[model samples]
Target: MSSSLAPGHPQVVVCKWSAELVRSMLDITPHVFVVLDEFDTAYMNPDWELLSRAERVYRISDFDSNEEISAVAADLILRRASIDHIVSFTEFSQFGAGYLEVLLGLTKDPMRHVAFRDKRLMKDRVRLAGVPTANWITLADPSREDDVAAVRETLSFPIVVKPVAGSGAIGTVKVETPDDLLPTLRGIEPDPHLKSDQLTAEEFIPGREYHVDALWSGDTPLYLIVSAYYRPRMSVLDTEPGADADATPPDGSYVVNAEDAPALYSRVTDLHRKVNRALGITGGATHLEVFERPDGELVFSEIATRMAGAWIGAVISECLGYEIHEAIARGVVTGKIPEVRPSRPYLGGLHLRPKGPGRITAIPDEEEMLAVDGVLRAQRLRSAGDSVDHAHPSEWCAFVVLGADTREEYEALARRVCDELRIEVEPAG
Candidate 1:
């Protein structure tokens, strides 16, 4: 029997990857041996059922012993002479999980992902490399009330608090005073899995938030895309008003939902070069979040070794007219980047949440929602008969996405669309 499989080989391979964006990329890829490693997490979407044609499927469990995970990895490697590529969609799992692949001797090096999941640790590394980051401190002990006081003393007014290691602004809270502290901390436990060993308190930069999507093709960056986050006009104004009102969530909290804001792509080539050099991030696709303070100071928020989450892979792909996730996969497989270029300059996205409480009965004007100029896609994660509560983490049913030729144009259209679009819901019976 031949020890290796070629491009035309009929053999199949499964994958350990999950996440809607990553799964979409894998589904569209051409034939090759794939090993889908984590079945439990990946199975939430019906997309997994389509992988039945893969060469091998490895169902690994998070609850399994490290020994079991290593064993499964070794088994897959032994069955196939080698894996052509290993790709992940998130910063945490890309390094956390990919390290295991390295331990099984599947990859050239594991050090590439040392900055895996912990946002605090990633910032620490980048800071040591002279990257300008937001004024921040991580809670050494989360359960202690005194540490909350300590956070107040160490930081200025309007501190940004969140789990030290989280993604997509999940579990993130912004508090302006001592009175606003406890409820914000407690409200974040939306899931038991949301718990963290520590929390981060950082000086909330009062300015515009932005992201840079860049791919590390070996020792240099290629196709850098810098995006300016639409300042949540609602959150920025609502922060102080709600602070005086109550500590309840979704209603009285100070956090921006990405879906609510539109992101603009700019050719900030110089800033991209400076940030990449500062972080020493030399491999894979990297997503960097930043806050450009009103004084023109560019303060770093956090940087992920992978693409920005919350369907950002799709946003970048749409804006640039290239497949970034697949490009990352192919680069990992071949150690080279094919010639791909940014096709257009545009702004994209609107993450929406419900304005009032009730079970969503119907979304009456979805076609109208899509009719606005530069509105590429509009979707509501919640459907008819779905109920949403005053929630945290910004995952709500009433959402809309818009794309435009200019950031100003997109924001204007989004505000109008949000006002005009309505979710007819029946009040609690």
Candidate 2:
């Protein structure tokens, strides 16, 4: 009999929810049954339902309260079941970890999986263990303007303001001056539903950024892939000429959500490994963002205890010939080490930005762009007549993936891909 698919069905939730993740898990367990506990963020609607029909199915909904969520998690344990493994990959998984312990019947220490939502606390503990980190402070009272002022005085200009306990860069802002502080505060004010832990402010380090995709095997590091950040398309930045002058600077905080470059990836691999050990993060799949200063020092921006978002999973696989998400899922399920060998020496990927702002009126040269040598795949996220904001990566319109034999070959293909593809957005006015 297949595992149950209902909420709190312990055995059914072992498989990952996303298409890419599911495909990877199937490589290990072809007939896997996945109990999707929370469907809102992890999986979309009709697609999820269709997949559930063929595979072992179970569904779960958000509980009315935190207590309910905890209760449901606990009850699943009392009903003894043979769940080969228990796994969680979402932010809410932190809350479920304790409950999963009782349900999984595992003897590992659960407390070691400390809740890492708090930037101040997470960095503090890591730093005390001799990890290199940026100077940061938490403002318990974001309502008090003076506290914001105090942070500015201490961190100086170009400081990053964000919720101390948060992810996705929702209320994150880079304040460049005393005048910019109030405007930045006003911007995040609408996020009133934000948690108190979402109130940390820190100094902004000017450096080139990179991401390390790794796994932890019994406190030993197993790096699956390392990404070189050649370009960063923060949502707050302008997509074109006039958009920059009109919109407020640092309006959005999602880093690498919109666009990235594939050229700088190799140089970053060693740098990330060094910092990962220093930070005392020796397990699980971590998406570590780092900043390489002009002076050659690598500084940390932040690290998420999950995979890098925004098609990065696919990007990593295409560029480096490694399946990172698959490694993470396998490790979570059986506590087994993943075997990953990069198949190619050189590759590249690129996301096209709107040459200018407006509605996406047309993509002029599709076949010509696709015909470019080394271009492996192209996906256009926006369709004709789709309205696009100048501020987000989704609004950027399209992406291209390529495999190459040399760094020069990969870079040349990327430039040609960007140059040949054309995007036209209708002006908002």
Question: How many backbone overlaps does candidate 1 show?
Answer: 16
Best by lDDT: 1
Model 2, 131-179: lDDT tens digits are 5567887777776878877777777677777776555555566778878
TM-score of 1: 0.75
**How close to the true structure is residue 230 of candidate 2, measured as C-alpha lDDT?**
51
Task: lDDT for model 1, please.
Answer: 0.56
- Give me the runs in candidate 1 sitting further than 4 Å from their true place: 6-55, 63-68, 105-114, 179-190, 232-280, 322-324, 334-345, 364-368, 371-373, 398-412, 424-429
lDDT of 1 by residue, 1-429 (tens): 345444542222223454443444455444443434454456554345555544545555542246655766676567654554455554434543566557656556454454455667767766777667877887767578788778877888788777766666656678878788777676666444543457778877777666777777655565565655544322522332111223222221111222343232332344555555655555667777777778766676777767665545556666556666566665554456557543324445544545556677876455666776555655556787888554443554533445555545655665565456656667767
- Candidate 2 residues lying further than 4 Å off, grouped into runs, are 1-12, 23-58, 63-68, 82-86, 90-115, 165-168, 189-197, 232-282, 319-325, 334-343, 363-371, 392-396
Error of 1 at 280 (Å): 5.8
